[model samples]
Target chain A: MKLYDLELSGNCYKVRLFAALAKIDLEIVPVDFLDGAHKREPVISLNPWGELPVLVDGEVILRDSQAILVYLARRYAGQAWWPEGAAQQGEVMQWLSVASNEVQHGPNAVRLVDKFGYEIDKPQAMRLTDRILGLLESHLSSHDWLALGRPTIADMAVFPYVALCHEGGVDLSPYQALDQWFNRIKGLDHYISMPGL
Target chain B: MKLYDLELSGNCYKVRLFAALAKIDLEIVPVDFLDGAHKREPVISLNPWGELPVLVDGEVILRDSQAILVYLARRYAGQAWWPEGAAQQGEVMQWLSVASNEVQHGPNAVRLVDKFGYEIDKPQAMRLTDRILGLLESHLSSHDWLALGRPTIADMAVFPYVALCHEGGVDLSPYQALDQWFNRIKGLDHYISMPGL
Candidate 1:
């Protein structure tokens, strides 16, 4: 499979991490968002969203990082990465939405602000951070993983940006359970770094 | 199964459509999003995000509409409302992501703009609509549905906003094949309308 990716994007990193967890070796094609490579025709053909982490598995091209996670997990079913039952499946998808709305809008947006050197919308971003972190804190209080009591692609999708939330000026110190939960998720087999060429 | 939903919401409608296609007789619990019912303690307790289209089936209180789709598909595995194998499953997730990003951001956002009578930033929303519809047009040229030449939750998740793009002044005349594809999906056997009460 070919994964069109970016070096420093946490969203792109979600796919990279899931690929690692599922032991799926993929050819990574780097797209330069800063250089407007994502806007180019070639990259746009793979994903019209103008985003990175498009997975091309033969004739199939998948976009959206969390959706890619669901694809990988389902494609590689019977692995611990994707659970098989209803409640577990629901849990995975629930957290995937959380990753999309909260993690993406919160710490991830803050990272984009800093990364692009754009004017920081500090107050709004900070409010989002607090909202997301508070949710994470409560959920991680009893569970080791986000889904099915095991490490899942849902966790993979939400982990990187949240683990690195401090870099975006969102301190995660208050969520100790989330801190420990992060460590637990990172402790899985065949972990990989976010793509940084 | 009870699905808490706002009748006019495309996200909530997606979940309802999924349940309908799966032949699941889900109880509809209308949540008044505008009336702050979603913000009430009971619903908010289930989903910290306080979002709509939450699925409650026994102990599983699913918070996201996408998550509800995953749940229904998983529980009713014998149905074609979801794909049976891996490759097609990736397609399922792909369209689900498109629903979340493009469908939600483009047509759905525009519908809200009209439904709430908000002054639209038409230029920005137009850019989003054009890009999304263009992508859909290309995909529809080759595929009958979002996955595996059959209707699935992926189509349901994306259809509502896309079918109603005109409410936001989005002209769908450019996507001829996609227009046919939309009609096919909306005409499914077990299809149901978004809840009215």
Candidate 2:
């Protein structure tokens, strides 16, 4: 499988991190994001969204990190990461929606503004960040993992931007449970790291 | 099954519309959104996000309309709505992310500001709306459905807000393909409608 990747992108890292954790071999084809390569020929053709981390597995081509995680987990990683049961999938899926929506608008958006010079509403991003971090702290304070009582793709999907929150000038120190949860993920076998993480 | 719904909410309508099309019974418990009932007990207890369309199917409770759709399609509606294959799920999952993120930020946010008196960035929402609509129109111009060569939850997840875009001051007349797609969805076996749609 070929993964059009960018090492600095937390979205791409979501896919890369999960692939590493699951010990799935991926041919990482790094995109020159700074030079606008993502909006160019190959990348844009594969995914018209002009986004990074597009996956191509023979006849199948997919975009969105969460979707790629679902594809990889179901096809290669077994039912452990993405379960078969309906309720179980729903439990994990709620977090996936959070990863795509809240986490993207919150920590990820803030980081885009601060670290990458993207023109975004910093105040609004911070407000979203604060709310999501509080929710994460409250949830992680009681539960060890995001879903299935184990480390699934749910954790991987929400982990990158949050771990890189410091890059956005958001402090992780106040979130004790979040800190501990990060450590737990770092302690997992085959765990990988990106630059800001 | 119980659906804690707000009649005017597109998020809630996503679930209700799916249930109607799939012939799944749901006890629609209307929440008083104008009176702040969603932020209070019962709804808040089920989904700490204080969001509408909280589903309670026996012991399994779920938040996020996309997740709810997945649960319903997987459990009750069968594989036709949500396929079992990895690539198929990923294809549908991409649109689910779009529903939760882009569509929510675009048409939904615009409507929240225009119709519900919400404080939001209308310019930013319009920019997002333009981009997503262009993409949707382009995609739908060729394919009849969102994924798997047939109508799936991907179409359901994205339909409500886009259908109600006029309330947000969005002009949908230019997007002929989207109009046709809307008609296609409305032509489904047991189609249902809500207030604005």
Candidate 3:
């Protein structure tokens, strides 16, 4: 399988982190954002969204980092990375939605705003980040992982973006439970690092 | 199950629609948002995010409309509504993410802004709606449904807010494919209407 990867993006890191944890081998193709490789159709014909990481296995082309992680988990069962039952599976979906919306806009958005040199809407970003962190902290306080009593794709999808949210100028000190949860995910058998910008 | 509902809410409508389609009976409980009921606890205790359509199934307090849809789909699987398999399933997640993010900001957000008499950011909202509608049009051009051959949770999760994009003053004439797709979903066996403000 081949993955169109961006080293600094948490979304891209999700796919890599999942691949690493699952011990799956993928040939990584660098999509140089600075060089405008993403906009170039020769590369982007694989996925029109023009986002990374795009996973290509045979004829299937999947976009959205969360979608890719779900794909990986389902394609290879016994990874214990996906929920087996319905309620737990729903929790996985719930967290994925949260990761994309709340996490994307919260700490992740703050970080993106900083990285892209975009003006930060300080009050909105802070409130959103605090709300999301509070949710994460409260949930983590009672649970070892995000959902399903074990490490699942939900955590794989949410953790990277949130763990690195401090880059957005949001302090992590308040979410001690979340901080501990992050460390537990790091202690996984095979883990990869993001080359932060 | 007791559903906390708000008539004009797309999120709330999606859950009710799912319940209707799945034939899972729910005890409907209206939340008077105009009366500041959202500020009250127990309700706030269900979802700190303070969104509508919090499903209290015995003890499981599920927030986030998309998550609730997923939970219903998985928890009651033998039904005809939920998508099956990886590619189709990934497609479900993809549309779910789009509905939560792009749809949330474009149609859903605009709807809220207008209904609540908030100032309109016409240029920004128009751009977002156009981008989203364009993508939706492209997806619907070839496929009959959002993520599955049949109408699945993906369509159920997204259709309510998206079809009402015009409620937010978004022009829908350009999206022929999506318009047809909307009609198709509305043509479902147990289609329900979204209440006006």
Highest-TM-score candidate: 2
1 or 3, greater by DockQ: 3
Candidate with the larger DockQ of 2 and 3: 2
Tens digit of lDDT per residue, candidate 2, span B1-197? 89999999999999999999999999999999899898999789998888888999999999999999999999998899999999999999999999988999898888988998888778888988999999999999999999988999999999999989889999999999999999999999989999977
Instruction: Report the CAPRI category for model 3.
Output: medium
Q: B85-192 in candidate 3: lDDT tens per residue?
A: 666667677878887777876787677677676554545556667887887787789899877678888888778888887788777787889888878877777777
Steric clash pairs (candidate 3): none
Candidate 3: Cα lDDT at A115: 73
Global lDDT of each candidate: 0.76, 0.93, 0.79
TM-score for chain A, candidates 1 onward in order = 0.92, 0.99, 0.94
RMSD of each: 3.5, 0.8, 2.3
Q: Point out where model 1 deviates above 4 Å.
A: A38-45, A48-50, A58-60, A117-129, A195-197, B77-79, B117-126, B169-175, B195-197
DockQ winner between 1 and 2, please give it: 2
DockQ comparisons of all candidates to the true complex: 0.45, 0.85, 0.59
Worst 10 residues of 1 chain B by lDDT: B118-127
Error of 3 at B1 (Å): 2.2
lDDT of 2 by residue, A115-156 (tens): 899888788889889999999999999999999899999999
**Candidates sorted on DockQ, descending:** 2, 3, 1
